[model samples]
Target: MSAVVRGLVARGAGQELTVEDVRLPRPDAGEVRVRIRAAGVCHSDLSMVNGTLAPPFPLVLGHEAAGVVVEVGDGVERVRVEDHVVLNWAPACRQCWFCRHDEPWLCASSGTPAVARGATADGAQLHVTLGLGALAQEVVVPQHAVIAVPPALPWAEAALLGCAVLTGVGAVNNTAAVKAGDSVAVIGLGGVGLAALTAARAAGAGPVIAVDVSPAKRELALAAGATDYLVSDDRLAKTIRELTEGRGVDHAFECVGRSATIRTAWRSARRGGQVIVVGMGAKDDEVGLSALDIFHSARTLRSSVYGSSDPDREVPELARAVLDGSLSLAPLITDRIPLDAAPAAFERMARGEGARSVVLFDE
Candidate 1:
């Protein structure tokens, strides 16, 4: 049987989202139905609305989310009904080539069910973004698409573990593996960059520098453990070098996902340092680097997809950090609105208003 639910749906490319009636079906084999409690409004969601991503039309756009399992389908044993879970947009298929090589984060089959599952009141099929359309009040996803989280974790905070926290902290801990005393610089102080800042501080990295174009985010960055802050400008690389005593940071993270910021991250790292790209840029956008520049600079440029994380393992560790007070998820949430206000939340994100704007379904 299918149930009628209200959800935000994009009718066409570059169209505003409308809350409409959606028909959700019961979970099938190896799937589970989740009652979404909180969903983070991300830049990626905004990109989808503006056609930065070529997702099918009439799509439900959301990925960073947390919820409770209401029911499970046949063969679903990893999670039971009433279990709290964080939705994983990139669920690894263990049989994939990358999974076989122990790189499940790069799983070739991460994006599955390319077709949408639900339909509108008028009977038009609706595509669920990232195979886990969580913007709806409830969602049906594969068992592997949801990871059990600590019961004590708040839904608003737990929601971030799905995307921002996973990517940001994972970049520092798993992707770059920043060692103690290593100098780090993060470009673009959004939710992801701030998470990187917090993780660097927790890892005992020294002289953590934060770069951003917005002056409003400086205070938040500092509070999140940034040792130094700089406004994004032509002198960003030079400023970072000066802060690290003229050698540039040992590791530089680009979270802005733009060609210019990526170049900045490259220039902000030490000659032989690591430049980790954590942002998801558009396919048409390209970054150019001279042959000599690439050869002369002995730095390693790597892309950190989902923070090179295995959700089952890392989400629990991150939840523990929140419980122990070593990691602060509270400061990362700047705005909390109801589900109806989600479109406005995206507007705030476009204007660089805050770190994260989470839609509270419990409100």
Candidate 2:
């Protein structure tokens, strides 16, 4: 059995995304079909069209989403119909060496830019981003790709847990291991960066500094619990140091994913501080560091892939936090739009106009 649904499709790089009829096949064994409730318009989704990531053409372009399982294939016992779930882009294969070593985020079987799935209305073969193209009315994905969450979780905020919240919060708690009173600087004020700022405040970090190129983000930064907001400029590192009592912050997070911003993050940290790279960038773009600086600074530089998180274990915990009112997602969502308005949301994202523009599907 199969169904035709409206989905956002990108024909190629530098082209506008279009809403078109997509033919979706029924779930195979160990798979489930979800009725997408809300999907976040993420930077990584923009990467698919901006040439930062070279995915195949005629692709569906979303991975950060939440929905209700409406159909389950044979052998799919992890989730059932009517269960609310968050999508996991990088589902770990537990048998991999990295998974056995307690690093499922580094699971060997993940990381494909796109996977061949259903087709367009005209019968042309189509591909879905990260193996779960979710910016659509519905999606059929492997059962492992969906983690069941509380039914009461709001759809818009639940969508963020799959990407922005998970990646941003995980980078702070797991990758950087930020403790209370640890001074922190987060460079970039996008959804992930803002999430990092919120997580820092929740962890009891002091003087959480939020840096971005846009002066318009100051209010958003403050609301996200940033004690200070600085517009990125040539003297950004020096300005950050001045605010941190001339020693820089204990942790510097680079969420912009460019080499230039990575360098700024490195310079914004104290000599022995940790620098966590949370952004996904092109493979060709390289960061250059002097051998002398490396030896003298004694800093630890690492990349936090998918926030170094295990979604299966963490998404439910995050849901509990939301239910208990300990964590608030209100600051992260700037706009709630219908699916047809997704292209405009992408334009706003490119212009650095908002934090997150979520596409809401009708119930």
Candidate 3:
């Protein structure tokens, strides 16, 4: 038997999303059914529609989400019915070479942009974002797609832990290996960027500068523990260098997934510093770099996929921090909205108007 639930669906690229009935199949062996409680509107979700990514039509949109396991398959053991969990969009295949080598984030079998599953109300085949169309009220995913978290964790905050918190913090701790007193500049003040700021501050990084195209993000940047905020402009690199006393920052994080922003991040770092690309960009959107500049700067450029994090080991630890109040996700969530408001949330994200607009579901 299948379960019917409401989900946000986009029939084609650039089309307005519609709330429609989605019929989900029952969890088979090694699978589980999750009732989504909260889902964060992430930029990656926006990419699915804004031409940055090309996913199948009639796609269910969402990935950053938290929910409860309401049904478990015969072989399920990691979670039980009613267990709170965070959706792991990039679930690792433990037997893959990456997983065997401790690089599960680069799991060979995961991270598909869209997976064919379920059906629309009219019985047309459906595709889901990142294999977990969490914008829906319920989803049937492989057991590995859900990570158990503290039950006491709020649904909204927990949803963010799946993507924003994990990616941002993981980029800092795991990918960049940022140490105390390291000067940092983060470009883009979206949910992930702000989360990066919070993690940087927690790691004792100083002069943590936040940059974004929107001037309105100043307040958000400061609240997220940034020592300074700058509106992204032609002078961004020079300004960052000035703030760093002509040395530029030790690390520059490009949270906006654009070639121009990537170059800006590259320029915002000091010679021999690291420029970490935290945002996902379109493949054709190439960043032009001069060979002479690369040699002269001697800076390293790398991209952090899923924060280069293994969600299974990190989500539980992050949940504990949220439970103990050692890690605060308050700044990450700018609004708590109902599911119906999800389309508007995407608009806000497109405009770079807020940090994160979390869609909350009623229990």
Candidate 4:
């Protein structure tokens, strides 16, 4: 009831990810096995490999993925075998405090993953990332972590829906709630930042401004619905204000996850506007809050995780958006490399050289 699959495992900090033959675990009680089709190369996965988010070594390092259900364990009813699903890292324990409070994405019992080794292989235990290390050809995830979607949905696009798209679009639609005709600014033109741009446009945000250092990515930002693109420069805020009739954008999204970019997000928004932080930076890194700015600027700053979305509800909805052409995922998929090219793909992401390079396993 298992398969020997190729997976990327990073043994320790500053170590390269090794492609190893690993054992896939069988579904435990209330769990399901997924035949992974596509896995997006997220920045978090890069962070793990580069020692940004320090976790235990010798661990599998992927979470954003979409696959088909291959089998179901006893007492599992979330989805039937053969259904397509997107892997959800924030698996909600419905009875938990955050889940009970209508915030399933922040489910109190949802963060960590338990290594489920049906039988030991190489005398080492197998651990899943966020309960769904889906980088390999197959993955075993808890029933709650798989949100069933239409089989008609392509795996590559659905894979991104698992994280980046959800986080970006959800930030605008759910967290900041940018209204129609509202001017918005997005700091950082990575996957999530571009996603935020298009999502704001879909919601009727006027004059969506995208900021990034890479001119290449700035062009990509325009294609993804950014009305204006700004390269790194002085008077960035002044330029944004000039575009918005001397008042800054109503909402600003910080997708770079840096203290400096966060400050940009705060300053980019107009007085009484909102700033939503969507980046996942170092936990110890702090964003300075000035006493005068808070009182005089009339601005609101907030951090949003996973776009504040209900996975079960929003995953399928976002997929539908892609299916119906409301959400454009084609441009985001800038590169597709086979499983063997994963290392280089990671390198490309580390350098911020590509939009998205998904590892296609289906072949």
lDDT against the true structure, per candidate, is 0.88, 0.94, 0.94, 0.83
Candidate 2, run of 10 with poorest lDDT = 323-332
Instruction: For each candidate, give its TM-score against the true structure.
Output: 0.97, 0.99, 0.99, 0.95
1-363 per-residue lDDT for model 1 (tens digits)? 987877878887667778888898899999999999999988877878775777777888788999999999999999999999999999999998899998999999885523488898999987888888788899999999999998999898899999999999999999999989999999887788889999999899999998888988889999989998888888899989988888989999999888999999999999999999998888888999888988998999989989999988999999988888888987688988887888888878888778998888862
RMSD each, Å: 1.3, 0.7, 0.7, 1.7
At residue 163, give the lDDT of candidate 2.
95
RMSD of 1: 1.3
User: Candidate 3 lDDT, tens digit per residue, 194-306?
Assistant: 99999999999998999988888899899899999999889999999999999999999999999999999999999999999999999899999999999999999999999
Candidate 3 accuracy as TM-score: 0.99
Where does candidate 2 clash, by residue pair? none
Comparing 1 with 4 on TM-score, the higher-scoring candidate is 1
lDDT digits (tens) for residues 288-334 of candidate 4: 97999899999998888899999889999998988998888866878
- Which pairs of residues have clashing backbones in candidate 4? none
Alpha carbon lDDT of residue 281, candidate 2?
Answer: 91
Candidate 3: list runs displaced more than 4 Å.
none
- lDDT of candidate model 1 versus the reference: 0.88
Q: Which of 1 and 4 is ahead in lDDT?
A: 1
The candidate 4 region of ten consecutive residues with least summed lDDT is: 113-122
Model 2 error, position 130 (Å): 0.4
Candidate 4 TM-score, C-alpha based: 0.95
